[model samples]
Target: MPSGSLRGQVALVTGAGRGIGREIAIGLAAEGMGVGLVGRTHETLTDTLKECARHGSRGVAVTADVTRHGSVREAVRAVERDLGPVDLLVNNAGQVDRAEVPLWETDPNHWWQVIETNLRGPYNLLRCVLPGMVERGRGRVVNLNSGFALRPDGNYTAYATSKGALLQLSDNIADSLAGHHVVVLDISPGAVATDMTAGMPMFQDMKTWGSIPYMVAVTVDAARGRFDALHGRFIHAGRDNLEELVRRAEEIREADARTLRLRPYGPQDPMG
Candidate 1:
């Protein structure tokens, strides 16, 4: 069950022009969140806008290439001016330039492009967004990582490495900004039938997982901080084992909260 409400909040979803990002944007809008749709192409973004409107949300579309810092900064400013201060950021923009090449055989340029789009792009957005969130004392950040981040396969060197870095970055941010009421999480939405996988020859051989709607539910849940106790944790969508994971997260949060109150000097104390 989806467990969060985002009424009146503003959410920015990168790559919202299509695929998983589009689904996430629409889902947030359906849940009463104002949405900012961003993508490299305006036409694709317009499609997202229509979806948002259909869901009865205040939506704005912006064209920006995530790989460029200036472009992303501009997009964030536009979103704020058009919507409101961004309360949630879904770092969903990513690329896979080394899809079928071994690490040694992959072109350096392709590898770098993947890394730039997947890792640096998110870093740029966070740098531009986090300060405002800290000032507001509330925020949600969901990095769209992959299952390969935890378990990598061959011919996915670029994609896997970038997501791995993103997961680490999310953990580090979660730890550093816990006191600011900011929740940073890495969500690994299992294989969805997106364009990224549509043309892969072996795509059909893999197990079909949950659809985009399921991932959207998880995104909305994370944005409301319903999973705040799970900060720094990686969540896998549609996996039946999440109940235990959520319980453990709550336990950890309770423990952390108690420690903060009991011993302010503890290492885990955000105040320290």
Candidate 2:
């Protein structure tokens, strides 16, 4: 909320090796927050850590498979040892299906692999880091979600389903964390140009791309407590008018907006 407000804070970011994750880690560092760069590749993580250090922020490059609970725990332990208790958790590690094929034509093993990485990755990290955050009575989690999670996609079924499940997971946790002084927000960086997206055939024809810097700003705002009021809700960095959302947080809550829900047919409907 104020200048230097984030100084001395600790942030643990999964998939901090590259893309949006690397941007987020550096942004946090620029705000003077010590950052833990977690990813499977040590070289990339080290590169990110070096940049974070340029901001005079403490940083650690820890290599670990996010889908494994034990590996995640050890990684978290290492970060805490180097950077202090984690004040923020950025769940950015995820992947999409290699081919944008229909479910009937998709390889079952590959589908499961997508689920394991995209869904289970964040689950492992959340479980490992949340207890400490709750104990400390302060923390924030920013889940890198996707627009695909909100609608049915004819292709990339695995990616869509896993992201949808992740959205549900975040929503459920937000309710459980109601009084814990911790907040979790899901954000979609719509079709940003990254190594991952570049490999995807669908994005090649796309002209406009999401703003990487805007996504970084959103994370910074979350860490600064700007989006605490919108916990468990989905925020789109590429399209959302965040200031309007914050100004009308009360309206959003009253109307149950920005969340996954069953639409009512009419006022007389029992589900409404």
Model 1, residue 11: C-alpha shift (Å): 0.2
Q: Which parts of model 1 have CA positions greater than 4 angstroms off?
A: 1-4, 250-272
* lDDT for each candidate structure: 0.84, 0.91
Q: Against the true structure, candidate 1 has what lDDT?
A: 0.84
TM-score of each: 0.88, 0.96
- How good is model 2 by TM-score? 0.96
Ten residues in sequence with the least summed lDDT for candidate 1: 254-263
Lowest summed lDDT across 10 adjacent residues in model 2 is found at 1-10
lDDT of 1 by residue, 143-169 (tens): 998877776667888888898888878
Spell out the clash pairs found in candidate 1: none
Alpha-carbon deviation at 83 in model 2, angstroms? 1.0
lDDT (C-alpha) at residue 198 in model 1: 73
- TM-score of candidate 1 to 2 decimals: 0.88
Instruction: State the number of backbone clashes in model 1.
Output: 0
